[model samples]
Target: MVLQGLTVLNQKNYEISQSIGKNLFDNINEGGFDYVISECQTCKWQIDMSSNVTCIHPLTLLCMSMDA
Candidate 1:
């Protein structure tokens, strides 16, 4: 299962997703997440005022266990 998932990850072109695919997958599976976050700062000053989108942070286990 891991190998198949890894293969899919390898085919991806996104730098962030490819680098952290395993962790993202695990988070979704274990925590039942519906979306993944890919945050890159374009500028130091940032302000998020929109309320239409929802953010769900995966549990620590999902992020940490990705290495295993």
Candidate 2:
């Protein structure tokens, strides 16, 4: 059987998921999530994106994660 749940990992594992289109399959609007976060490997920065938007990050990245 296929178990369905959100699984978040470190930067390395996150990238692997991105490559395999794992992030594409997530249903962001179906849960208690304001946004999902992932860190940029190249810039050493984190980003938060909602279903209605991309990771523009007008607010602080550290603060966003704290709320999550």
Candidate 3:
């Protein structure tokens, strides 16, 4: 499943962000998706840093699959 536009709260709300991040990660794992693609760089970074799932840009996926 593709999750987009995820935003991390500022430093003052770090704990809140961690809780939300954990929930997001847990949901993604439960969904059994192969990839999580997002156009937002922050979303990509967050997913990459927090989970084992492959997170990529939509354009990257399009370019890679062009020959297929």
- Residue 46, model 2: lDDT of 22
Native-structure RMSD, model 3:
3.7
Candidate 2 C-alpha lDDT tens digits along 1-68 = 11111322465466554444434435544445554444443211222321433433435567766899
Q: Could you estimate the TM-score for every candidate? A: 0.23, 0.27, 0.68
After superposition, candidate 2 runs with Cα above 4 Å error: 1-24, 41-50, 53-59, 64-68
Query: Candidate 1: where is the Cα deviation over 4 Å?
Result: 1-19, 34-68
Ranking by TM-score: 3, 2, 1
- Candidate 1 shows a clash count of 0
The TM-score that candidate 1 achieves is 0.23
lDDT of 2 at 51: 42
Candidate 1 residue lDDT tens string, 23-51: 44444456654443423221101101111
Cα lDDT listed for each candidate: 0.35, 0.39, 0.73
Q: What's the true lDDT of residue 6 in model 2?
A: 36
What local lDDT score does residue 42 receive in model 3, on the 0 to 100 scale?
Answer: 78
Cα lDDT of model 3 overall?
Answer: 0.73
